[model samples]
Target chain A: MQLKTQTRPKVISVLVMEDRIDAATAIQFKERMRDVTKDAPARVVLDLARVQFLDSSGLGAIVAVKKLLGPDRALELSSLTPTVEKVFRLTRMDTVFTIHPSLEVAVASAASV
Target chain B: MPPQPVSDHDPRRSSLTLVFQADPVSIRQALQGMLTCPPLSCLRGEDRGMAELVLAEVLNNVAEHAYAEAGGKVEIRLDGDPRGLRCLVVDEGREMPGGQLPEGRLPCGPYVALDDLPEGGFGWHLIRSLCADLAYARVDGQNRLAFVLATGS
Candidate 1:
């Protein structure tokens, strides 16, 4: 559950460094997100470019992170791989969060807003 | 000469059997192995992804629910073909409650509260959505779950 965080102005982007987030690491992922975003800005963009696999447990963990951030802060996702996108699509979770096609786009949108 | 028969030994028809402890770490390792092996390795794009996701959900259920506190062994037998893969998972642990599978309804909706948002229950939904001919049975102190993952090939 290695996550790299970068803060820029109003938004912070956290890059998931690992290739897979499954049952084995969902809890850790959530906890790490909490720790990194504890005092961050109102918008958080999670870059999933490196993640190759995510199970339901992993998906749930991401949702948990969103809830943890509450209504004040937004948790946006970017660069979802083919399978990751499928999970979000099948679960209809893709509708819940703002999903950007790339990290640059996610951050750029944050800059504009 | 007559057309050749498609025997069980045909290279196109293959199966892989894996037996491991019912634990998250072990299940991860098993999934990695399966993806690298024949038939599963032969899958591509969304087909391969679906296989990994479905198997992960099923195996995780065994580790988290079936075994729970009482650790046990789990066996996975996968038969692969041009169309898709047939997966059978067996565990020598607790039977599914009421000896039946869950209905696997989606837990989220457009109006659910943020606090009430589900952190779980998505596993079965994913399994049901991606798998076909899904079946579960408790027999002779073992839980057997079978499903077919279509590769669209």
Candidate 2:
């Protein structure tokens, strides 16, 4: 459940340094996200490029993080691998949050907004 | 090059059986072992992804819901063919409520409030969507779940 955090002016990008987020690590992932994004700006883009797999528990943790962020702070997602993307798509969580193809695009969009 | 024929009796691609403690950490290791082995290892792209997702959900359910705090052991048998992999999961934990599987409806709507957004209950929905012929039975004192994950080949 390692996360690399890079904070810019308007957005904070937390890159997941793990290959899989499943039942084994979902709770740890959520707790880490909360700590990393505690002082996040308006947008927090989670970069999941290295994550090759995410189960339902992992998805729930992400959603839990979003709710933890509340209405003012937005939790966005970027760089979803095919399998991670499939989990979001299948659960229809894709429609709940804004998803970017890459971290750069997510940061750029956040900067403009 | 022509596609190689896949046979059920092929010596290199035989059914995989795994027995492990019903816990998250053990289930994770089991999933890794299953995916890297024959038949599952032979899957590509979406098919492989689906297999992992479905298996994770099923195993996690057994650990969290079925076993709960009581703890138990789970046995998984996977037989793969051209159409898909047929999975059988057996556990001695408590049977599913009502002696049946959940309907696994999508938890949230397109316009649900942020606070109302569901943080769980998506496991069964995912399993149902990714697998076919999903069935549950309580034979003797064990819970038996069966499903087929198509490779789309």
Candidate 3:
């Protein structure tokens, strides 16, 4: 999966350019995310506005990515589609990560810091 | 995983039973069929997400655990209407890890420590939480799991 990254002073935003994150793509997604996030800022937001479907594997992969980023860096999630958002809530992962309604909102919050 | 032809119709409650090879590609086809099924076509928003998520978890589990990297058959039966949905999944493979379904529990979450947070083991929890009723049974060398989600009625 191809990912787009935008760097700023406060946070680096990675846009996931896929519609579905399932068992079929979860591994690749995580691997690609690692490459994109290697040199990112401490605060990173995964913009998932385009993704409309997510399964448990996808959720686990995201959590793995967060752990890989280490303790100091925070991996935030933004622009979660309703379907993707439900997975986070049902699994209670919503509490684990800082979630935002949109990429702009997450970026704005980080910029203000 | 093997391919088996499915009849377009099943007489029981207008149910549809589709047998798929226990793999990611076949799982995706089954999911696509559910998303477009006439009875479930109206599913949108939270309901749609729940169905897709639960289905994926169950099917993937069969592919990952039951089959254990071997070829197998996964059967998915759907009986749903405007009010609710009942999903039955059957797999011809090894029994559950301990010959039982994973007891669903809320994961320790919203934690400050990364080590404390869990990455996997959330699938069964979500399945139990979203489905109004869930049951699992092994019959005649087949693993059967039934899930009911009440959309309105």
Candidate 4:
């Protein structure tokens, strides 16, 4: 899985370039995320607008990436497709990570703060 | 195109069976190969996405816990209807932890600390929540799990 990253004023949005995030791609996704987020700013937004299929393994990968970012830095997920959002809501991970409807909103919030 | 609502006597009901290796690649290939099915193909992307997500979780569970990545076979049977789809997964690798399914609910946890967050237990929760009906049985030395989902075609 290839991740696209854009660094703005306060937030760096990492756009996930994939349609499916399941068992087949979860490991690679985590590895790629670790590399992309190793030196990110204080707050980062993960843009998942194109991710239409996300399962448990994929969710775990996200959590693992969060841990890699450490305590001070924050990881927020944005642009969740309905299916991906359903998985997060069902697992109650929606409450764990801050969510936004779009990357623009997330970035704007970062600018506000 | 949308699939019409199905009845008991509807001729559109169809069944398919296949044996797959208990592995992620095989399970993914199996699901990918199913895109041509009528009921699944007719459903909207979100519904199909949920179905595929649930199916992938279940299959990965079998490969991880049951077969332990050594080697095993999973027999899958899909019952297709114009209104919905039912799937049966059978494997001989292992039984449920205590001969029963998990609570099928998310275990509450504090979302505060990074160490306290969960990573693995979410699979069964996702499966149980998305599926309409889920049944599990350990019969004749095989772990059989049957689940149904609405196609919303």
TM-score of chain B of each: 0.90, 0.93, 0.82, 0.85
Per-model TM-score on C-alpha atoms: 0.95, 0.96, 0.90, 0.90
Q: TM-score winner among the candidates?
A: 2
Candidate 4 CAPRI level: medium
| Best of the two (1, 4) by lDDT | 1
lDDT of 4 at A5: 96
What lDDT score is found at residue B107 in candidate 3? 60
TM-score of 2: 0.96
Q: Candidate 2 residues A6-113, lDDT tens each?
A: 999999999999999899999999999999999899999999999999999999999999999999999999999998998999999999989999999999999997
DockQ of each: 0.86, 0.93, 0.79, 0.74
Instruction: Provide the lDDT at A2 for model 3.
Output: 76
lDDT of 4: 0.84
Clashes of 4: 0
- Residues B1-153 of candidate 3 have per-residue lDDT tens digits of 775444454222255678889888789887898677644665656777777888898899999989996768998888865457888999988988787788878667455588767767888887887886688888999999998876752
- List the candidate 4 regions with Cα displacement exceeding 4 Å: B1-12
Model 3 chain B scores worst on lDDT over the 10 consecutive residues at B4-13
RMSD of every prediction: 2.3, 1.4, 6.4, 2.8
Error of 4 at B30 (Å): 1.0
